[model samples]
Target: MNWGPPRTAHVTMTFDPEGLTRTQREGDACVACHKKWPRPRTRIGRLPDGTALFACPECADALLPQQDDTRSRPQRVAFF
Candidate 1:
């Protein structure tokens, strides 16, 4: 009998801005990881101008940007 590779599960994630409690920037290390999401929540940071970024825990992992995926650039070819 052979043990196969572990199967990964697909999870649905949701984000609610109002649900997040205001947490100090220094208190969470996960703030840096949340920057990869398309929509990250803004919180007060230690500095006046700085901010603490946040996203739903589940969304954080799922929403992260994939490596080496290049976006299409518009071609600029002059037509005579």
Candidate 2:
């Protein structure tokens, strides 16, 4: 099979599970704020055992670094 890059890649760094609770470690709660009412679906990072850590959309944005906007800049000119 010649499939391209993975549909969803987790580039976030792995977090230490030292002080995390069972629910957070199990992905049932947001790893950042620990909100349980709405199940966190954004995969923020992973644990030592490869357990995917999740967080709410807001938390995810806060955790992840802001993307640079390069499209709006004018093209650069090179001089000989």
For lDDT, the strongest prediction is 2
What TM-score do all the candidates reach, one by one? Answer: 0.23, 0.72
- In order, the Cα lDDT scores of the candidates are 0.39, 0.80
Kindly give the stretch of ten consecutive residues in candidate 2 with the minimal lDDT sum: 1-10
Candidate 1's displacement at residue 51, Å, is 1.1
Q: Tens-digit lDDT track for model 1 on 1-80? A: 53522221123223333434344243343344534434443322223333434444554445544345388889898995
Please give the distance, in angstroms, between residue 45's alpha carbon in candidate 1 and its true position after superposition: 12
Show where candidate 1 strays beyond 4 Å: 1-17, 24-50, 54-59, 69-80
Q: Over the stretch 1-80, how does candidate 2's per-residue lDDT look in tens digits?
A: 63532222247678899989999999999999999878887788889989988888788888876766668978688975
User: Could you tell me how far off, in angstroms, the CA of residue 53 lies in candidate 2 after the best superposition?
Assistant: 0.3
Candidate 1 TM-score, C-alpha based: 0.23
lDDT of 1 at 44: 20
Point out where model 2 deviates above 4 Å.
1-10, 72-80
